[model samples]
Target: MDANDLRDLGWTSEGPDYRGSRFHVRYVAHIATHRQGGVANLVTDECRDTRYAERMLQEWARDALKHSGLSQAELARRLTAHLHRAIDRAAVNKMTLGKRAIAGDEMIAIEEITGFPAPLENADGLIKVPMLDSLVSAGNLSPREPVKPEDVDRYVAASGLPPGDWIALSVEGDSMDLVSPPGSVIFINRADTRLVEGGFYVVAIEGDHGTTYKRYRASPEHFAPYSTNRDHGPVIIDDAFRVVGRVYRTMLDIGPHASRRGK
Candidate 1:
């Protein structure tokens, strides 16, 4: 349910339709932040009870339904039933537990009423997908963008290669220079080369755990992590090294510093 997963779900923030006027389950929590008073006040309380937030949202949904053209009595009955269901879903006991509250059923009821489902919930239910976070979120790279996905097969065929999963990470150190500098964004492809030879890549290793952005060299037995910096020596890879992925894109944004140097 991180930023990347949201992007992949076709949830764009740029459209007027996506503005606060629309009510999605996940968006409910976000939009609640800007509510005129009551809900916003509850959500903003540093030590506010979770049940309070749930109750406030349930009330808010009831109001929305009334505006949806339902009669007063019908709205009252429907909202009451939904609130009871939400209380059970949220696991709220008779006694208010304050800090231990979970969003529970009320949130789901809100979604059901609004007709927008949460991606994380769907991932757990029908999709059975993995928890995700990576480059597609940071705008570093994408599998398909201006080109529609149905047209991807044609694009891949024209390029003579299969489409790959892309990821991006910030370069932290100077080990990779000349090609990539500190703070550069590097895009990687895990499917590109499973077992890589000599090439720039993002290597994920355990034990001495780290994700290194470097030029990886594979030999008959052992491997080496080479650095473009002349002063830095190659990191010898033993059985301990594991390759997570490889670097496929690099963006250097030194801003005024790069300009000040006139490069």
Candidate 2:
């Protein structure tokens, strides 16, 4: 998760709760730097358009618990472990009802722990999602910000996509060409950040490297990428790395394939 993720979800950095807090400032600055240059598209308390029916994060959590059978405290504890930070039940409770915007990491942490799919797009049919100008490098080490270019815009529409905050990112490397070919546009759901073994994800490496699109397999200690290009290999899972979101579909100029054909 990065600044674009926060911005896409309506998180604001200029709220009163964030003011005068160095802790918030530092982390906000850290994530903001994930994008090398483009300005944020839109940073409002409410989403720019009314087509979306936001199933609030807290509401999503309550619904998720019906299946996971975990209490808020238990979920918070699991999240604390996942993020290696102290996050209590109160923090979780306050998030949906408070002024402080939820950070991208926690957004993902909640998704991973709940095992619940984020709410699908609440529209009737034929939805148009913005095509981000940025390309998510399909290779790992050569990180390029998947930050959307707001200067210019394009939109694409497709039917039958399993929805959840869907956005498109152009692909730039051959590492995952069997699925996401270079020059293709990958439609990913920012709300679906869970790391299912052998699942496709758009991931990021914090400092120098940017973002990559690949299939993820988890061992006890590392994130192994199943790449068509053998040169791109496994990455040790650490604070420096994060699964940005799952790649749900890919639109290659040659054709669009809904199912995974290779590892």
lDDT of 1 at 262: 17
Q: Residue-wise lDDT of candidate 1 within 200-234, one digit each (tens)?
A: 76555444435456676556433343446677765
TM-score of 1: 0.34
How many residue pairs collide in each prediction?
2, 1
Tens digits of per-residue lDDT, candidate 2, 8-92, equal 8776665334433344555655445544332333433236443123335445656776667887788889977765567888877
Best by TM-score: 2
| Alpha carbon lDDT of each predicted model | 0.45, 0.60
Q: Candidate 1 at residue 53, lDDT?
A: 55
- Model 1: how far is 122 from its true place, Å? 26
Residue 201 error for model 2, in Å? 0.8
Q: Evaluated with lDDT, which candidate comes out highest?
A: 2
lDDT score of model 2? 0.60
Q: Any runs in candidate 2 off by more than 4 Å, and if so which?
A: 1-124, 135-152, 255-263
TM-score, structure 2 vs. true: 0.43
